[model samples]
Target: MKTQTTVRRSKYAPSVVTKNDLLELLNADFTRECRAIYAHAVYAERTRSRDEGAAARIARYGQETVLSALVLCELIYDYGGTVINNLDELNAVLNADRVADPGWAPETARRLHERAGQLRSAGEPGLAKRIRRIISAKKGAVPLAALVSGQQAVAGR
Candidate 1:
């Protein structure tokens, strides 16, 4: 049976989200992570010959995304939600189209942060915290999303 929870938009107004609703968001994020994994893999392979160091770094970011997806799976099960993997559908986009521009990752991270805040307000602090932990505030950090997505350069090129 699915359960619904309330999140306070304000003292006077509250919104409700069913467990399936949460699952929908989680699954969507899972799909996104899968896409990122594919994109990073393509990028890593493409950059391997030209810039081995960059390729390695991109590969590491892809690994981190895998870890993040696992965390989301755990959250899904814990909340009585289903984990769906639509890798085939996610792969429909061309490999070249999959690669993220430098700004895309950070913007995506910012949106995730917003979702985390919503989860927190909806009495899902643990899940929210897990999501938040994946985001990095430090500039030029390890995760590809945060590293290349940020505005500043890596200091020494």
Candidate 2:
């Protein structure tokens, strides 16, 4: 049997960054310093929790998971730079398994995706690309798979 592929366009066209752009950003001294600091803090927090086993406790109870999800939602909403107009759509998009397990409701996901697309169109290329990748990875529709594959191919891996 033969299969055909179809392309689906993002509702908004946001600028995207090349690997070179990311490399350049990473190579900057200021950026390196900031990254180092962030890494250190993350490590320290994790290390300190090791003694009390708070990390294990949190993980066992799902507190960390819940907090992480909340943080993700806030970060996406803030960075997407647009308010999701349709709660239902947003839930659907977020709930799609490819994007997340026990995902956001379909409506929530759709709204989030729409907002993320708007951010992509607003010159926040990196954030937009991240959102697009998240949605694509969730494996919802054929168009998304095509786009993800196309991206991987372009990356020459």
Which runs of model 1 end up more than 4 angstroms from their true locations? 1-16, 89-96, 137-157
lDDT of 2 by residue, 9-99 (tens): 5556533445344323222312222222232233224434333343233223233223323434444454433222222443433333242
Model 2 scores worst on lDDT over the 10 consecutive residues at 25-34
CA lDDT of each prediction against the hidden true structure:
0.66, 0.38
The true-versus-predicted C-alpha distance at residue 50 of model 1, in Å, is 2.2
Clashing pairs counted in every model: 0, 23
* Candidate 1 residue-wise lDDT, 1-157, digit = tens: 5446654345323244666776787787777777777777776776677667777888887788788778878877887788897767445246435446556566667656765766776788898888877665312345444433431243235
**Candidate 2 segments exceeding 4 Å error:** 1-104, 140-157
